[model samples]
Target: MRMYEIVLDGELTSDLPATAGPVGRRQEGGSTVLSVPAAGRDALEEVLGLLESLGIGITAMSEVEAPA
Candidate 1:
């Protein structure tokens, strides 16, 4: 499995509805961040889409994977 942590733009989790993301939640200066560990691109995108539906911009994205 792979790990994908999205540092979203503006408030992410707080403003995000219940159906937006997974169980991780954190907050940065002006943006709320959610850490969806061990998630694939498709899964991440689906979460991102849910965020978009709430009118949140995806500021940045980072990916990591377990040692093979």
Candidate 2:
């Protein structure tokens, strides 16, 4: 699975749904950063959709490169 870093506009009031898979969350200033792992693009899209449905706003998203 590929790793992605998603930056939300603000801190999430609750943890991400289990469907999002194992995720890491941290607060960066006023924004919340989430480390999400997905099998592919489609899976990542699904996670994004789920976040939207939960009223979370994404400010930025990018794949995380693995260390050599």
Candidate 3:
């Protein structure tokens, strides 16, 4: 599994998935963090497509190693 951190200018959906969807939550100093996870290539592409369709610009992403 891999995790991707995406930053956008606006808000996102709440019913996101834990494996391959966006999760919005409040952070330090009232900032919001939107995170998503991808298990493989197909999952990652699906996430990108979703973001593109929503017109939500993705700022940055980091690949994280998932624990077994």
Candidate 4:
């Protein structure tokens, strides 16, 4: 699995439950960050698309080292 960090433009506490592959979540400054552990590229893209459809502007998306 791969871990992805998706940073959005604003808070998204209410929208998280509907996320495709969120493993964790938290607020970073003015944005809501979602930690998504995807099985592959297809799954990751699905999650990103879902979030984008909600009108939340994605500020950043990057692959990160998974937790130990």
Candidate 5:
């Protein structure tokens, strides 16, 4: 699995859909940061699709080391 940090353009007003995987969510400035774990590209894409469907705009995304 891989960990990813997705930074959204605005604060999330509600909880993320369950399919987003086991996520760590928090706000940093005006952005909502989501720490998601995916098994592969397909899993990551699924989360991205869910975010798009929710009308959330992603400002940035990058792979990250798993939290201890």
Candidate 6:
């Protein structure tokens, strides 16, 4: 599994995706930061598609290092 930080151009409500993985969200300036962990490539793609369907602009996306 890998952790990802999906930074969006706008703030999102908690109920964005009911089937999404455990998400941690917060607003940073004018953007919303979503911390999502994916089990594999399929899962990651699903998240990306969902974001696209919602028409959310992705400001940034990067893998997060696992905690030691």
Q: In lDDT terms, which candidate is top?
A: 5
lDDT: worst 10-residue window of model 6: 13-22
What's the TM-score of every candidate structure? 0.62, 0.74, 0.54, 0.75, 0.79, 0.75
Clashes of 4: 0
**Evaluated with TM-score, which candidate comes out highest?**
5
Each prediction's number of clashing residue pairs = 0, 0, 0, 0, 0, 0
lDDT (Cα, tens digit) per residue for candidate 1, span 27-53: 888876666656545556678888777
Query: How well does model 1 score by local distance difference test?
Result: 0.65
Off by over 4 Å in 6: 38-40, 66-68
**Candidate 1, residue 47: CA error in Å?**
0.5
Write the residue-wise lDDT of candidate 4 on 1-68 in tens digits: 56888888888877554435445778999888887775566657877777778777989988888778
Question: Model 2 — which ten-residue stretch has the worst lDDT?
Answer: 36-45
lDDT for 52 (candidate 6):
94
lDDT of 5 by residue, 1-68 (tens): 46888999899867776765677789999888987775566657877898898788999999988777
- Candidate 1: residue 10 lDDT (0-100): 72
Every candidate's lDDT: 0.65, 0.78, 0.57, 0.75, 0.81, 0.76
- Clashing residue pairs in candidate 3 (N, C-alpha, C atoms within 3 angstroms): none
Candidate 5: residue pairs that collide: none
Ranking by lDDT: 5, 2, 6, 4, 1, 3
List candidate 2 segments past 4 Å from native: 38-43, 66-68
Please give the distance, in angstroms, between residue 12's alpha carbon in candidate 3 and its true position after superposition.
1.0
lDDT of 1 at 12: 49
TM-score, candidate number 1: 0.62
Quick one: RMSD of model 5? 1.9
Please, what are the lDDT tens digits per residue for candidate 6 over residues 45-66?
7777988998888999999864
Candidate 4 residue 11 Cα shift, in angstroms, is 1.1
Query: Candidate 3 at 61: error in angstroms?
Result: 1.1
